[model samples]
Each structure stands twice: as structure tokens, then as C-alpha cells.
Target: MRQDHASCNISVGSADLDLDGYGNIMAQSQQIFDCGEPLALDIDEKILLHGTSWKNANSIVCEGFDNRMCQNAFYGAGVYFACAACKSHQYTCNQHKKCCSCKCQRTVIIARVALGDSYVATETRKKERRPPVRSGSSGTYDSIVVKPGLIKGHHKPNQVHQEYVIFDREQAYPAFVVEYTL
Candidate 1:
């Protein structure tokens, strides 16, 4: 629950958290108006994990995810989560060298992600900036899924492990911050 990293001079801004929470609430509320009635709970919502440096983890919990800050866009310019802990653990590198003497403790966030409709991705979509627009529809796919399987004629899969990505920040809620040492 404690999302702040005081030693790194990073504190969760109440306004930031409140504003993001409010926006998500409003978005969900609008669905009722758009559909003219309340809808059933989304089946795609999932509990997923995301790993990052301790500093970045604080920012994500406080300000919410900003895909623009994504360093790797292998799947797309979106926030990445994984069903497998080891997949997310690949990203828990300490980028803030000066902030920590030893990078023993790693951080991973447990998030509630609304993965609504997912599009399975091909290696060709590696540079995609966002989810592909749905065929013959104005709305885009809600998320992207990259699985571990070789494309025909290819030697290996573009990804070794599965990854899930959501382009919209509101689709994810940082529910827990877990710190552990390997």
C-alpha cells in the first residue's frame, strides 16, 4: 500500500492519484450512458503483474502509466503486464544507480487490468505505437497479446514468454507494490 520511495525522494501526490482515480470512475460511468443501460462486469479484467525499477514503480502507482515513457515497444507503445512473474521480473532492473548502493530488492506491481478485447500480435507489429484498429470498426483492440510460438518459417518466436499490453492508462490500476529480494 505504501507506494512512496522516500529514500529516492519520490512521494505519491494525492492529487495525482485522486485525479487518475476520478477519471477512471468517470469513464466507466459513461459506459452506462453510451449503452443506455448498465452492463455486466467485464470478463477481460485480470489481475496481472508488472515489474520495474523501484523509482519507476513509484511513478506508475502515483501518476498512473504513461506509455510514452515505455523504453521498449516490442509489443507496442503501451503498459506491459505479464501473467507469469518471471516475465515481468525481466524488467526489474535498477536504472537509478546513484539512488541505491546495492540492487538487491526488486519491485513488482500487482495490477487490475481491463484487457477487454485482445489482438494476438505478430512479429511484424513490433513497432506498433498502439493497438491495431479493429477490422471494419472505428474502435481499436483493447490490448495486445504476445505468445511464445514460432511463426512459420521463423527460427524462434519474437517473444519467449507471454506479455499483455494495454494502451490506455485507465485500463489498469496499480493495486499492490511488492518488493522482494532474489
Candidate 2:
């Protein structure tokens, strides 16, 4: 089993993006996903990749285009580059060079779940089911008004559970959020 950490994912199936922009699908290469909503990656998922770029800033934040860094660096020595080229570089999930090479910020990873094996990714986080449970459900089955029958886990616990990253969410994108911080 391959162990990894990751951040938010962008889907490949997103409809609005120009399909002709990125080069032809390289053999078995996957497609790009769409992110209908916005999300953030925990520090563990996207490591800080520092470099210098001359492009204008994407937001009021900074002009750091390729210079921007992932909040969470992969488990390795940062990203590997074929030079200064942006597309030529790749992120390593493992500290070694053999682990899966995560290209593009929204790269998908493989994961095994309680149901079965599948793919999950950062890009699809927004597409998944995020049902909101009422506080009463947490109250549990109280045989007696004074006693609670079952213990219920928080639907989405506070940020503490967001600390470590899971690396594999499902495999539509392999990477999922584990435990993380802003």
C-alpha cells in the first residue's frame, strides 16, 4: 500500500475549462476535472513550493504564480523539476523518487475504502455528500430521558480532525484530506 498526504483537489471533468488548452491526453493520462465550488487544502496536502515568477498576482495576495508554494509539502524533498519549467516539475508523495508523481495541483491518487477500492481526489471534495446532521441526532437513543443509548460521532468534527491528510480520498482523485490546519 502506498502512503501519502495531500491537499484540496481540482477535478478534471469540469465543463467550463477549454479542453483544447492542455496538451493531448498522454496515453493513459487522465482528464481534467471541474470544481463547481471553492475549497482549501490543508497545510499537509500542498507543501510550500517557493520560486520566482514575473506574472501578475492571481489575487490581492501576491504575484507569486509558479512561485507560490503548497501549504503542505509532499512527504519528499519538495517538488522535482526538469529545469525551471512549471509543467516539467512533479510532486512526490513518498520521500523517494519512485512513489507516484503528482503532476498538476489537482492530480488524482488511488485509495482503498471500507466499501471497496476506488479513486478520490481534491477536485471532487465539493461534489461528495456532506449532509448536515441536526444536533438532536447527536443526542442519541435515550431509553430513558436521563440516559443516552448510542454515541454519535460528529458529522464533521471541528478542525482538529483536519490535521493529518488521508492522501487517498477515493481515487476519482487519490488524495483526500486527513488531519490538517489552515
Q: Any residue pairs clashing in model 1, and if so which?
A: none
Q: Using TM-score as the measure, which candidate wins?
A: 1
The clash tally of candidate 2 reads 36
lDDT of 1 by residue, 1-182 (tens): 11112223332221101121224432343343232433223425556678887888899989997788876456768898876666677777685422243547888887776676677776645577889976644456777876665533334644456677898898788877889877
Model 1 regions more than 4 Å off: 1-43, 95-103, 151-158
lDDT of 1 at 18: 15
TM-score quality measure for candidate 2: 0.16
Best-fitting candidate, scored by lDDT: 1
What's the residue-level lDDT of 102 in candidate 2? 38
lDDT of 2 by residue, 31-66 (tens): 111123222222111211112111211221232122
lDDT of 2 at 159: 14
TM-score of each: 0.68, 0.16
The segments of candidate 2 whose C-alpha lies over 4 angstroms from its true place after superposition are 1-13, 16-22, 26-70, 73-89, 93-182
Question: What's the distance in Å from true for residue 56, model 1?
Answer: 1.0
